[model samples]
Target: MTVDKESDKGPYICNGTQSSDPEYTQSSDEVTLTVAEKPEPELTSDLKGAALTGNSVTLYCTLKLQSAGWKFYWSKDTQSRETETETNHYFIRSVSVSDEGQYRCRAGRGNPVYYTHYSDALWVTVSGESPPVSLIINPSRSQHFTADSLSLSCEEQRDSTGWTVKRYTL
Candidate 1:
């Protein structure tokens, strides 16, 4: 019996074989399997608005990848230190004033293919221990106070930045 050689066209032909050879076909399929590189991870923080003093804040870093086979890394801007590889989330428990800085993350399988991406710098400001306490007089109690006239003044004991003054009469 004589067997005809397969044409070298299309995916069906493997090493010029008409009959499907398990070894040849299996090896060929293995070669065709593609391992896609994971995309860079996205970094985000749970901090927003003004952080309050003595507040336990969790800074979350999320790693979104095109491929599932990837590990995540987290870091702060002050130092180029990397945290442990997490599959999903990274957190900073009981955040304090000192923990304020920029952060970022990276997604990678191992060496050579690793990539890093930085997130926007978030300024974490801790609120004062007490709300801005201020004393104001609807009508100023000056030495020369005149009747039927309104004079208003504001006195803020605490130092505050970005404060707006308003006067209301009842």
Candidate 2:
């Protein structure tokens, strides 16, 4: 069985251009670094949609090659080192407006380690404005039988004047 390096890790994305050195060579009297050259680490995020303030955000550092025994480092825009991970990912809990910004990561391996160049930077943003009202559906089921009707409705909280209920046929 192969172990997955990304399992149970938070989601992240690399936003901008990535830089990878073609070859990083380090040799010792008894050992030579013969591992195949690896691509630049990739930064990624789990925000599929809009990210609002006060939510958790997960960031990932991914290597195209095996990431075993690699140490990862992270940095935010215009800042020194933010943090480091022994593994290939990092988590941001309770993200606020301050957390919205560019982030980058890189990896290093072996003693007196040779480091991979930083991955592309990612820009993160959080919205503080109130979210828009959304419609809700009744009879919450994954699959519905044909010819069966479902109830759908939306309500506006302002002055109680924006409540709407409608039905349509599929």
Question: Which candidate achieves the best TM-score against the true structure?
Answer: 2
The reply for model 1, stretches above 4 Å from the true place, is 1-30, 33-38, 66-69, 85-87, 111-113, 130-170
- 1-170: candidate 2 lDDT, tens digit per residue: 23245352443333333246436444334422233444698999898765676678888999888847889988988588558798787888877888888899999888998788889998888776333344666787778888989977665534433434455558
Screening candidate 1 with a backbone cut-off below 3 angstroms (N, C-alpha, C), the clashing residue pairs are: 140-151
Please identify model 2 stretches exceeding 4 Å from their true place: 1-38, 129-170
| Weakest ten-residue segment in model 1 by summed lDDT | 1-10
Computed on alpha carbons, the lDDT of every model, listed in order, comes to 0.56, 0.73
Q: Compared with the true structure, what per-residue lDDT tens digits does model 1 show for residues 50-80?
A: 6665556565555444556666666677467
**Alpha carbon deviation, residue 25, candidate 1 (Å):** 15
